[model samples]
Target chain A: MSAFAALVRRDLVLAARIGGGGYLSLLFFMVVVALVPFALGPDLNLLSRIGPAILWLAAVMATLIGLDRLFQADEEDGSLDVMLGASLPLELAILAKVLAHWLTTGLPLALCVPLFGLLVALPAEAMAPTALTLLIGTPGLTAIGAVGAALTATMRRGGLILAVIVAPLMVPSLIFGVSAANAAMGGTVPFTTPLAILGAISLVALVTAALAGAAALRGGE
Target chain B: MTATGLAASFWNLANPTRFLALSGRVLPWLAGLAALVTAAGLYMAFFTAPPDYQQGDTVRIMFVHVPSAWLALFLYAMMSLSALGTLVWRHPLADVSQKAAAPIGAAFTLLCLITGALWGKPMWGTYWVWDARLTSVFVLFLIYCGILALWRSIDDPGRAARAVAILTLVGFVNIPIVKFSVDWWNTLHQPASVFRLDGPAIHPTILVPLLVMAVGLSLVAIALHLSGMRTEILNRRVRTLTILQADHPSEGGI
Candidate 1:
């Protein structure tokens, strides 16, 4: 238990010190949302309508922010080798890393969705739900992205392959997140329906991604 | 008793030399059958199948479209099993199976998409619809591309096999989600009329060719895979020999 906490804490401390972890995704989230208006022409109504989807898409892209370096950094510095030999199981250690990663990268981005909602001219009623979905969905995105990260942990340029590899895996998260957020806006479907599914996806992703990432890490050795 | 015997025989074939020798004799027969069956299937598809009352000539596209679609999905199933082979059993042939199947899967996916589009143009009056079924297929194609890219990027065979095996497993898990989510996202698409059998009448004219084409394409796929595995094994031997030759300049490698 302490070892897991320590791994999580160690990752958090490293992310905080790195400064590259959180803000890059936050900034990306803002940039992508900010660009949508320019691309679509500053139609406030349009922005409000597609706000949830735009936020969701940006959130998905943002989730990929630090993933390439997730395991690569550890792999490069040889800490990964040490971790492999540690009393802590690699899957648990990876789960901790993913948890820490979601905290620094996904959580921050999700929390800021409401604030960035202003940029998209998102409706007041929809903001909370959209942000809520992003909050829930981003964790799954990070977990799925982590598997890609572990696969390319030893590669020189993993970022290019990372998005391609991760994108297809992210379909369920995107579908559920966007639909759930849209559900909040008002429709025959209740908000809780897709939201529940989204939560389930997050839970599944957390388990599966950790196992997969650990497999990649061990297999690479 | 038979099950254990079958399992024993299966394991014995894991030796690449034995696999190669076995496949070598089977290849000609497999290739011939594939060619013969595919020709028969195509002939049946194009010539025998009646034009649909609703769709007329465009219904012929289903013959091509549906079978490729089946192969696209079926190939993934085979790849998933092979991925299990690579990861759980560490079968050398499994990775070769996976590597060879990706391109074939990709080709089938591309065919499915193109023929789907061709069918859509006449029936739906549009070449593409951002429908649930189409989107999932697109995602499947992308997954194949991603796997192929991953395989190429890694140089070490053993490591690449493991990494890609893990990736293939992830994809296998995700594909169902992709299919389900897309189905939820758009239930309005995939017109019932287009499928023909959805109309409460199962016509033998349509059923026979579709099944034959499916079996034919599958055989073609298997033949390609067997030959591909053979080539891969020989390639690995060459690679090993070259590496050994590099080690000792004075002495030639076997």
Candidate 2:
């Protein structure tokens, strides 16, 4: 198998086997959604109106919560150094890890947007659009968080600080994601515009963030 | 001089001892000039500039609010250049400059926000709004905090330098984004009253003092930044010596 494919599979397997932070972030996503209805009251009308935004915010928090482990584990096991020296190229290796991370963390949250959406009283029509937006934009979140993760890879407990550093960078994604989702719910603006922009952001992030993350990982060591 | 020679001369300014000597000699004059300019600006703003026909005395807040907003954005831009110097050119002084600038930049941004809120309360009847201009500035403030947090988390200065440089460049992306956000979204924040294609909307009475305040405050900010960079250099030297002492117990304390 190609080194990239092998590295990706290794991360997927590790995340599945370890099964703690990944699943925990998914649970955290749900718990955040569940907590909101309590604060905002049980008004379904109000809940559905703002449901997409609630889901998007929860998704970002979950992505951030799971981000630190993206590089921390590799650093601890010294596999990061091994990968750095490997012929696969550090940027591509980081890309593969981000892909695997998205699969475990971002993809699951996007997929579960509907299940969690129900708790927030998201209307049925908006469910798929909300999920779709999260699906498209969460990859950008994962990528941006990857740079933060790589930069803090050497720190003992970088989780909280990583969130602080990465959160503002995630703003554009959140804005467009919620904007796209909101448009689908019968807003004045068309849904396709923000959705397209969200895709462009993810596309840009996938390349620049991988390169930046690699540089950070290399510098951090 | 050729471009390379010009670059060499510029790079020489990164030398710590030379920087200290130059800044020490220059510092007093810069500080005095800043005070003089700032005081004159304030006097003009208060005693000379007429009250807005509309906003009256409250319009005077522009002297503090507008200039701080400019500096907040300006310092971030300056730090971005310093970030490029650190990452692309590997200038060590660039790291110190960038590091020193973060807290000062944060201070200006905070000052901008507070004065803005103070102005907004009387003018707009609310101290806060989620208007695009306000939101983007708030985000800029958060980005400043994040950069400071990242710097604090990393102990080794060299490693911290590179990491923060990369982060600085990343955050720099937001400046353009913030600028256009006002255009993209319908903002409650007023349109450009000062920077217009034709001319400023304000009469010279207000414009003059505002300009004076802006330039004076910027000079003050620069003076503060120079002292900040100097302190950072001394701090790093002390840190290195302490680490060396930790490693060599037999050596006498300095």
- Top TM-score hit: 2
Model 1, which residues run further than 4 Å from truth?
B1-8, B174-201
Residues forming the 10-long window of minimal summed lDDT in candidate 2 chain A: A16-25
lDDT, model 2, position B160: 94
CA lDDT, candidate 2, residue B139: 90
Per-residue lDDT tens digits of candidate 1, residues A1-221?
58899989988888888776877778887898888999999888888888899998998888876689999998999999999888999999999999998898888887887799899888789888887898888889999999999999999899989888899999889988998988888888999999999999999999988889888998888
Clash count, predicted structure 1: 0
lDDT of 1: 0.86
Task: State each model's CA lDDT, in order.
Answer: 0.86, 0.90
Please report, as a residue range, the 10-residue window in candidate 1 chain B with the lowest summed lDDT.
Answer: B191-200
Best lDDT goes to which candidate? 2
lDDT of 1 by residue, B55-87 (tens): 998888888787788788888888999999999
Residue pairs with colliding backbones in model 1 are none
In the range A155-182, model 2's lDDT, one tens digit per residue, is 9999999999899989989999999999
